[model samples]
Target: MPESATLPSATTKLEYLRKDLEDLRYYLDEFSAFLPL
Candidate 1:
C-alpha cells in the first residue's frame, strides 16, 4: 500500500479515537455529578 493512503487511515483512526475518549469523559463527568453523596 502507498504511504499516502496509510497516513490518512491512521489519522482518521486517531481522530475517531480522540472523539470517543472525549465522549466517554463527558459521560463520566455527568454520571459523577448524578451520584448520591
Candidate 2:
C-alpha cells in the first residue's frame, strides 16, 4: 500500500479525534468547577 493513498485519511481521522477530546476536556473542566470539594 502506498502512503499517498492512505496518509491523508489517517491524518484527518486523528485530527477529528483530537478536536473531540479537546471539547470533552473543556466541558469536564467547566463541570468540575461547579462541584464542591
- How displaced is residue 7 in candidate 2, in Å? 0.5
Model 2 earns a TM-score of 0.80
> How many pairs collide in each candidate, listed in order?
0, 0
Q: How close to the true structure is residue 24 of candidate 2, measured as C-alpha lDDT?
A: 100
Q: For each candidate, what is the lDDT?
A: 0.95, 0.95
Clashes of 2: 0
Deviation (Å) of 27 in candidate 2: 0.3
Best by TM-score: 1
* TM-score for each model: 0.83, 0.80
lDDT of 1 by residue, 1-37 (tens): 6998799999999999999999999999999998985
Question: What is residue 6's positional error in candidate 1, in angstroms?
Answer: 0.5
Model 2 lDDT per residue over 1-37, tens place? 7988899999999999999999999999999999985
Q: Provide C-alpha RMSD values for all models, in order.
A: 1.8, 1.4
